[model samples]
Target: MSSATSLPIIFVEEGALAAANLSAAHRAWADANGFTGQRGRLLALPDPQGGLAGHLFGTGPVADRPPLVAAQAGAVIGPGQFHFQGASGDPTLAALGFRLGAYRFDRYRAGKPAPVLDLPAGADADEVDRLVSGAALARDLINTPANDLGPDALDQTIRSFAADRGMECRAIVGDDLLAAGFPMIHAVGRASAQAPRLLDLTWGNPDDPKVTLVGKGVTFDTGGLDIKPASGMLLMKKDMGGAANVLGLAHAIVSAKLRLRLRVLIPVVENAISGTSFRPSDVLTSRKGLTVEIGNTDAEGRLILADALALADEESPALLLDMATLTGAARVALGPELPPLYSTDDELARALMAAGTASDDPLWQMPLWSPYDAMMSSKVADVNNAGTGGFAGSVTAALFLRRFVDNAAAWVHLDIFGWAPEARLARSQGGTDQGIRAVYGVLKQRYPAA
Candidate 1:
C-alpha cells in the first residue's frame, strides 16, 4: 500500500511501543523527543532541512478494536493526506475516526483546513465517505440554531436533498396536515408562525423491500403552553436532532444505493408558545385515530412522531425505525453518549447491538415493558401524552410510540439525547449525531448491494 498524497501514520499504544519498528534514525528522533506512546500523544519528526517528515499517533494496543483515537492524527498532523503504515486495529474505523475527529462546524466562522487521509488498503472509500458525510450532515443540522432551521427550512432541505438524488419528495404543510389526518403534528406545530409540516422522501425500486424511517423534527421546543425554564430552553434548538439523524442515515442508504426501498418521514414542527398553543388536558386526535390527552406539552416529540409512525406503519414496511430526542429520562438512564433502543424482536436487537458495538455508535437495549402500558392510560382520551408518574418515563414513551406501530415486520425506537453535553477525545462538545452511524452499519450489513 503506497500513496503519494498521504503521509505514513505509525500507531503506538502504552506499554508496547511501536517505535521499535521504525528505522533507527526515526526511532532515535522519537526517543530524543521524549515520545512514550501514551494514548493521544503525537510525535512529528522533521527532516534535516526542517521540511516534511512522517508522524507517530499514540493509540491503544494493536489488539484493541478500531475507532481507536486515530482521530488525533487529524487533530495533530499538518495539512495533508495520510495513510496507515502499520496495524492499528481496523484501518477503516481508524480512517473514520480521523475524519470524524477532524470535523469542525465552522458554518459561521472561518476555520483552518484539517488533514485528510488517503484511503487505506482494505478500506472501502465509499463506505468511509458515506458514514463520515452522514454524521457530518447530522452534526451541522443539529448545531445550527433554530432561527435558521425552522420547520419551513427543514421542508426545503428535504426537498433539496430529494431533488439532488432524483428521489420523490413532498411536504404536507400547515392546515394540510389537518386535512391529511396528521392532527397531532398540526396540533403541536400550529401555534408557531412557521406552521407544522411533514416532510417525506422516497427512493429505490417499488419492488424492493420497504424500509421506513420516521424522525421527530421539532425545530425548537419552547414546551408550548407548558413552558420550559429559561435554562431548559437554551438547548431546545437541537430538538430536531431526530430529523437530522434520519436525513444523515437516509443519505448513506441512498448514496450507497442499498438494495431496499427507503422512505423517510419527518414531522417538522416547533413547540412554541402562543395564545393558540394547544393546552394541557387537551384531547388531540392522531393520524392513527387514537386520542391523546396532553399530560405535559413538553412531551411533544412523541405526539408528532405518533402521527408519522402511524402513517409509516400503514405500509407494513419490512423495517420501521424512528429516532427522537424524546425523553430526558433516557439521558438519565444511559447518559448522553449511548442511546437506548426499544425493540421486541430479539434477532433485530442482537444485530443492532452488534453493529453498534462494532461501529462505536453504541446503544443500550431497553425493554418495551408491557406492565408500563397502563401508566399512559388517560381518563379523557385513549392515551395520555406522558405518564402520570416520572418513573420509567423513557419506557412509557417507547410504549406510547409502540401503539402507533403494529404493521411493520420489525420496529425499533431510539430514545436519543442527540447532544454531547461535553467534549470527548474525537468528538467536540455540543450537538452530536448519536446512534445513526451504528444504525447505518446495521443496514449496510443487512442490505448490501449485489
Candidate 2:
C-alpha cells in the first residue's frame, strides 16, 4: 500500500498516554481496554465502520526503549503494509527491528507470513536488506544441526557463498592442514569422521587497507576426550556460531561493496570423541610454531582459531577480529545476551562499543589482563590451550589466541554465546547473531565507500 493509505502505527510513551492525539471514540476504546503506553503493549484501533484503522503502541520511557521495540508491533500486526507515525528512537533501527522480528527458522516446519513495513524515511533500503540477510544467514547456519553442517558441509556452504558473490574461496582440508603448517587445527579436528578444514574467502581490492576476520568453526563440540556432560552437550551444535556470524558480517561488507580488502578465515572442525581425538596433556604445534599443551580437550576452539589467526596476522591486516563460542566463563561473566570483547587497541574498542550501542548489538570490553597471560603457561609446551586455574577462562582463552597474533597491527577477540536462551525484542530464542552488526558498523565507519 502507498504511504498515504498504509496502516499507521502510532507510538506513545509511558506518561504521554493521556496526551496521545486519539479521536474521542478511539480514546474511549483505548481507555476501556486499559491501553496504557507500556513497552511492548499494543492496542489495535478501529475505524468508524469497525474495520482496522491503525495501532496504538507503548514505547515506555526514552531511556528504557529498546532499539527493536517495533518488533513487537510486527509480531502481532496482521498481514498488511504499515507505516510508523510518532515513532521514537532511530527510525532506521526501528525499520530494521520490524524486519528482524519477521524472521523465523522454517527449515523443518511451516513459518508465518511477515507483515510488511513501509521503509521509514531516511532509512537506506540496501543497508536494511544487507543487515537482515546477513543476520538471517548467521541464524540459519547456527540453528542447523551438526549432522547437516559439519566441516565438509560448511566447506561447501562457504564455497557456494564465495561463488555467488564472485569472491575467491579455498580450503585446506584434513591432512593438508598439517602440510599447510596448521597442526593445531589438524589436531583438534582430526578425531571427527568428517575431516577438519580451514576455509578462506577473500574479497574487495587487494591493495586496499586489509581487514581480516578469523572465526572458530567447530561445527559440533562433543568436547573430545575431555568430554562435556549430556546437559552441556545439548547446545554444542551452535559451536560454529562464530563462523556463521563472520559469514553474516562478510555478507554485509561485500554487499555494501566496502572499499577494503577482506579475508575470512574459518577453521572448520568437529571436536568428536574417537580413538584419534587429541587427548589432554598432548602438546601440539600451531601455525605460528608455538607449541600448545592441551590442558583440556574441550578447549579446542582456541586451538583451531590460533592457527587461523596466525595465518591472518601474517599479513598484518589493519584490523584483525576473531569471534568464537570459546568459553563458558564469558557467559558466566556477562550472561547470554552480552558478549565479551577483548581488543589490543583501546581506540578500536571504544569505537566498537559506540557502534554496538548504536546498533543494539551490545558488547562489553573485557581486559586482556596481561597478568592472566601467565595462566596459559605450560612446562611441557610454549603455552597451554586451557588456563592452569579455572579462573578467568575467557581472558585466558583470548590471551591464548593473542599469542599467535603478534604481527597484526590491531586484534580483537569476541567471546560470544551465539545463542539466545530466550526471545527478546528482535532476537529469536535459538541460534542468533552477536557482535557482527557492531563490527559491521565499525567497518562501515572506518572504510566508507569511495
- Candidates' lDDT values, in order? 0.86, 0.89
User: Lowest-lDDT window of 10 residues in candidate 2?
Assistant: 1-10
* Global lDDT of model 1: 0.86
Candidate 2 lDDT tens digits, 1-450: 237768988898887876678899988998899887888888999998999998998888888787878877776677778888775567788889888877788898876767788887877789989999999999999999988898889999999999999999998998998888999889988988999999999999999999999888999998899889999999999999999999999999999999999999999999998889899888888888888888999999998898899999999999999999999999999999999999999999999999998788999999988999888888988988888769999998888888888878899999999999988777878999998889999999989888
269-367 per-residue lDDT for model 1 (tens digits): 999988889999999988888889999999999999999999999999999999999999998898888899998677898789888887778888999
TM-score of each candidate? 0.95, 0.96
Q: With candidate 2 superimposed using the best TM-score fit, by how many Å does residue 251's alpha carbon deviate from the native?
A: 0.8
How high a TM-score does candidate 1 get?
Answer: 0.95
